[model samples]
Target: MSTRQYGTFVVIGSGSGIGNHVAYTFAVKGFSHIIPLARNDWTYNRVCFFNAARIVLGGLLESVETIEENFETTNIALYIVAQWAIPRLRALSASSAAAKSSLLVTNSLLYANPIPQLFSLSLVKAAQCSLVMSLAKTFNSSGIHIALVTVGGAVAPEKLESKKYC
Candidate 1:
């Protein structure tokens, strides 16, 4: 991919996991400003990438409070950030033909293959996928590209044997 050196890149949940890796990759790719928000931070921008999520492990046995908290962290948080980022991205795209603005949200296969042991997480992921699709439909015609990065499993360093597939 060609690097763009002028836009701001924001990654939520950048303290760890996929968020951390994305932030690092964009920085290396020459984004002029890179904002890294931890799971609790609300600081908002361009190329807005949402990866803030919590894994709740109790399934149907999980307390209501726990499930609610999971939704707050994962789904609600993305909505909040999207509300802040979308218009700015739209404006940016309109102002410059060279501008590339996008909203990218990390998702999981749990939304499709529901796991009983992670019921709350599964529910929230489903909600998130729906939200991302809606955003894409609403914004794509205006030049802002909205997408979901649905990860099928945990992200980890590739084992040596996996390199052969590459």
Candidate 2:
């Protein structure tokens, strides 16, 4: 016999890739209340590197400032979502004795072992992990499960392509 997971799921960063996959997977597994939160797309040109490593490497240090700004934007968005969703999550859990609400944060394994060029991402993921851990303890007795799922390695191109259908 298999155990079924019940209640509402609030998935952050459900815009693409792992986030998209996770949200779809939860729905396929019989989760009726699925909240997928996605961030607005941030666009930038690749003019800094036009088939030349030297030019890109030259601007590496400056990218950190840009990365930090992006991280702040994303962090604030996530905070807003969490603040708005918590009350609903509580209501859903309290309405049913068996219901269990969970907040699932999608993170990268680079959080633990920071990558050189992806330092900004690593910092954000690490902070998210910390937030999840703190929330887990804070809400332990409230029947709300907070979890951070870290994904590592290269995602197959097929999976990336399949995200469109998901």
Candidate 3:
């Protein structure tokens, strides 16, 4: 089947991981109007207990604030992108009643299999799942397709130093 069957897509979190692969695959399959959301790199650095503990112990309130800002950025930015992209997706649907434009999210297995130390990520992913589902239900008749690609056992890229989660 041709990827262009969907016309176009809004791929939030396309900067890396499954989102990147999805965007590239769509492009390869003749999708020319894929919109990839660009997020700040600072959001990539998630907080750990070691860092959080150190900050609390050392009275590093600035570091704690930075972490909070990053967490908020990571959590809210996707929704913001989706809010903007949905209208465009709806417009695409209006242009071609047969072709449904998609909002594809890159979710992680952590949504179901929670990691104790990464509790925040788990919570965020769960919330994201809910958001996608709500959008899907709300816009099903509008020809806007909401889809989730849940990634599991995805390893770090070869260039990056791998750290054991345990």
Each model's TM-score, in the order given?
Answer: 0.69, 0.57, 0.53
lDDT of 2 by residue, 65-164 (tens): 6666645654555566567656666666676675657666666686688766765666666776676677668865676666765668744534543434
**Location of the lowest summed lDDT over 10 successive residues in candidate 3:** 47-56
Give the clashing pairs for model 2.
none
| Model 1 misplacement above 4 A | 1-45, 157-166
The residue pairs that clash in candidate 3, if any, are none
The sequence of per-residue lDDT tens digits that candidate 1 reaches over residues 63-151 is: 98988898899988999998898889999888766677889999999889999998999989999999999989988999899999888
Cα-based lDDT at residue 91, candidate 1: 91
lDDT of 1: 0.79
How many backbone clashes are present in model 3? 0
Model 2 regions lying over 4 Å from their true place:
1-60, 160-166
Q: Rank the candidates by TM-score, best first.
A: 1, 2, 3
lDDT of 3 by residue, 1-166 (tens): 2425556777887666777677656755566567777575523222110001111122223344544544465446766767787787777677653544777776777668966555555555677778778877987578777777676854344423232221
Q: What TM-score does candidate 1 reach?
A: 0.69
